[model samples]
Target: MRLALGVQYDGRPFRGWQSQREGGTVQDELERALSTFAQMPLKTVVAGRTDTGVHGLGQVVHLDTELERTEFSWVRGTNAFLPQAIAVQWARPMPEPFHARFSAFERTYFYVLHVSPVRSAMLAGQAGWVHTPLELDAMRQAAACLIGTHDFSAFRSSQCQAKTPLKHVHQIDIRQHGNFIHFRFRANAFLHHMVRNLMGCLIAVGRGRYPVEWLAEVLESRERRLAAPTFMPDGLYLAQVRYPEIFPVPAATLTSVPWSAVWSDPASSS
Candidate 1:
């Protein structure tokens, strides 16, 4: 039988989602726990792979197995052996055709920034910090220019292995709450470090280092050198993955950050 699982993890504890030879990865830990439960080795394919220090609140993965267990057993049994920072949120039988990565139609990410003169030790690995005040209006204007299908070479990392730099950005929403600013993005797919690189540019605009028009100029240039430095990964979260209705994968709630509720509440905006 084929099964799909919703996974949540604090990426600060490991080296990202892929299983590495060094073995300190979310995939490695999850496979280890699943293997323990199945009494045999099990491998999983994730919908998206994240970078180090990037958290996942609604990541989905699928695996094929011969072992039969109740859905509750799958969740409880596997999580029993998993580390505290990683969890199997839900598990369900899936059609053989349902692939975690390929079946995904869209992916959403949220980048949270804490803007203040003094940083908070409590939010060290939980949010990106900006000592300078961010201009929300300027950041919003810059973000609007990036909405559409375009060759996002400027935002892509040289290490990216994606065959094409062309990507469709469906929407970019910027919201501010007190000293925190949220940059929410929805796209058909993302290139490696694409969101982080874009965040770097947006931060520059918000900080008065760049004009709003610079964002469009950079996009048109298609030069990575013309973009700002890739921002920190601490605040990036894989917030959602959308699949077709034919696939019955349950919607996984975003729980990696405390401010996720702000995304839905209209009153949270500055």
Candidate 2:
């Protein structure tokens, strides 16, 4: 039987999501924990692989296992082996056809930026820092060009292994609450560093370093060099993944995250 697991992590301590020979990644730790619990090596397929310093609020993974256990047992048992930074949030027996990555229809990500001249010690690694003020209107106008289907080649990283650069960006919402700027991106799929690359450009426009039209030009140029440098991963979070109704994945969103109390989902419609 195939088992699906919901996971959440702080991500600061992990090398990244993917497993490596050094075994410092979130996947490596998770697999090791699962192996110990099952008394057999268990490999898992993730819905999305987040980079180092990028947190996971609603990440999903699936594993094929013959081990039968209650859902609560799976969750509590797995948590018993995991570090404080990571934990299995929920688990369910999945239909054989429910492949984690392939079955996902959409993904949502959020970036939290602390806008202050002097960084807050409390939010050090929890958020990205910007020393100056940004024009929210400018960022919104520039981000508007990203909505709809398009080839996001310019925003893709050179190391990205995705088969195609084309992606559908369903929605983007930029909001500012006091000293923080929150960016929400919902897309069919994101290329490696795509959101970070887009963030850099949008920030530039907000800072008046470039015009709103520049983002459109960069998109049309399809040249990675034309875009701003990729932003830091510390503030990035894999907020949610949407799958077909056949699965019993939870629908609760960004509201459940630790940061939600301060940086909740935007009130506007997508």
- TM-scores across all candidates? 0.96, 0.96
List runs of model 2 lying over 4 Å from the truth: 252-258, 261-270
Query: What C-alpha RMSD separates each model from the true structure?
Result: 2.0, 1.5
lDDT of 1 by residue, 112-212 (tens): 89998999998988899999998889989988888889999999988998989999999888888888998889999999999999999999999999999
Q: For each candidate, what is the lDDT?
A: 0.91, 0.90
191: Cα error in model 2, Å: 0.2
lDDT of 2 by residue, 117-205 (tens): 99888886688989999999998998989999999999999999999999999999887888889888999999999998999999899
Question: Residue 208 of model 1: what lDDT?
Answer: 98
Worst 10 residues of 2 by lDDT: 261-270
Compare the candidates by lDDT and give the number of the best one: 1
